[model samples]
Every structure is written in structure tokens, then in C-alpha cells.
Target: MLGYGGTSSPDDPTLEAFKYQKMLADRNVILSSCGIEIESGEKAHLVGHDFSAIFSSTIVFYYPQVALTCTLMSAPHSPPGRKMDLDVMEEITERELGFEFTAYRPFLLRDDSWQLIDAHKESLLQSCRGLTRNGSRTSCLRDA
Candidate 1:
């Protein structure tokens, strides 16, 4: 599970989809929606995939420092060991450049500054997409 956060705006799945496609090119990470839209007499409702609902809730309580980095959470399916966890993160991170995966110490940005976080995230995503587009098979557990 890879998590992200932004104060710029609420979660926009459509916009996020484009960004995700541009960033996470690994075929494993599949982002989709399973909600409904209802329009009533004088009101409307738009519901989609709530990433928080599925994302690990312990991020805030367990890894507070992650709140500042471009990365919010990264939960990998390894053999229940620190080394395996590092291996998985490294493999996925290798798809993109400039990502130093150190458990929860992702330093994609400086000091939780939201100014460049989105751009950084997009750049990384674009690079990840390029890897797959260039015919390399770097697999993530979340791949489609």
C-alpha cells in the first residue's frame, strides 16, 4: 500500500487517475472506483474509491514523520522481515529515479512543504510510467 496526502484539495479520483497513470507505471498497482452517483430532487452525491478506507490507518499514529514527505505510506507484502520489506520498496522505487526508500523516511520533499510536493509526485509518477512504457517489467505487488 502506497499512500499520499495533499492540502491543496480533496481527493479527486479523475485527476488522480491521470496523475497515477503518469507516475506509477508498474502494471500491478490498480486504482479503480466502486461507488455510485446519485442525483436527487435538489442535491447530488458523488462517491468513489476512498483510499483512506483501504489505506492503513496506522500511518498517522505510527509514522508521523511520513506526513511531511511526498510519500504517506508504503506497505509491502514481504516475508514479515525488515530486509524483505526493504527489498520490496527498493524494487518498486528502482522503477523511478531519486527515490531513497528508507522504511518510512521518504524524503521526496523538504519539511512537508506542499508547494513542490505535487510536482515531485508527478515527476516520479511520470518516470515510473516511462519505465513500463520503455518495456521494462518492474513489478509491484499492487500491479494490475
Candidate 2:
């Protein structure tokens, strides 16, 4: 999880949190456009077929960091492991959007000093699925 601390803004302590939320939403669009069956309001299950052509293709195009981060997670340090977990969460995005996999980096802003924040990886994954499902439900209702 990426956490942004040291923000001087009294009005936007949650700005980073909201930014990542939008990132997850954007990732969902990429997945749906790739032909994944992400229905609204349902938990996404990674099926074996999902691991085959569509998902594999999506991962190949959009989630290269999965392998890299997984490898790094297996390394002998806490920092690398945390980084790896972040990558893994990003991979879930690839699964959701059947896109070609790619590496992901958090957007960093420059302040007076270089401040690092944490990304909530689990929340990202959960929110993506939730948003996708919610969209699906809205569409279905509209159709009905």
C-alpha cells in the first residue's frame, strides 16, 4: 500500500488516496475493453480459462511487472517484498482489463523535499472489482 505523508494541505490529506482510486478506475476500463467478462457487483474469480488466452494475453500486454515484482518479493529484504506486493496488486488490474501487461509506478509529486507515500495495494484491487461490478449493474439496469 502506498501512503503519502507530510502533506501540508489541510484540505487534501486524502489526495493521494483519491488519486490511486482513479488509477484503479482507469485500469478497469482498460480491462473491460480487452474482452474480459467483468460483471458488476460480483467478485472476480480467476478461472483456468481466465489464465489461458484472454488473461495471458492481457497480462502479457499489461502486467509485465507481475513477474518482476513477484521475483523481487521472493528476494531477501522487506523493502523489495513490499514493492513486490504493490506489483502484484497492479497485476490484478491487468486481469480485470484484458490488456497487454506493463510495469506500473506511482505518480510522484515534488515538494520542498522528496516525500514518499504508500499505495494501498489491496484496496486498489478491491476497488477495481467493485467499480467494474457496479458499472455492470448500472448497464444491466439500463438495458432492462
Tens-place lDDT per residue, model 2, 1-144, is 123344333356667534534544554565468664334522232221311333333432344442222212212323211334656744674578543132313332334223222345554445445566464332222112
Write down the RMSD of all candidates, one decimal each: 15.0, 19.5
Evaluated with TM-score, which candidate comes out highest?
Answer: 1
Q: What is the lDDT of candidate 1?
A: 0.36
Query: Residue-wise lDDT of candidate 1 within 1-144, one digit each (tens)?
Result: 233552234356666643433333321223222221111112112112334322222332333332332222233322212344556766677657434334223443346644554657765465457656442232222211
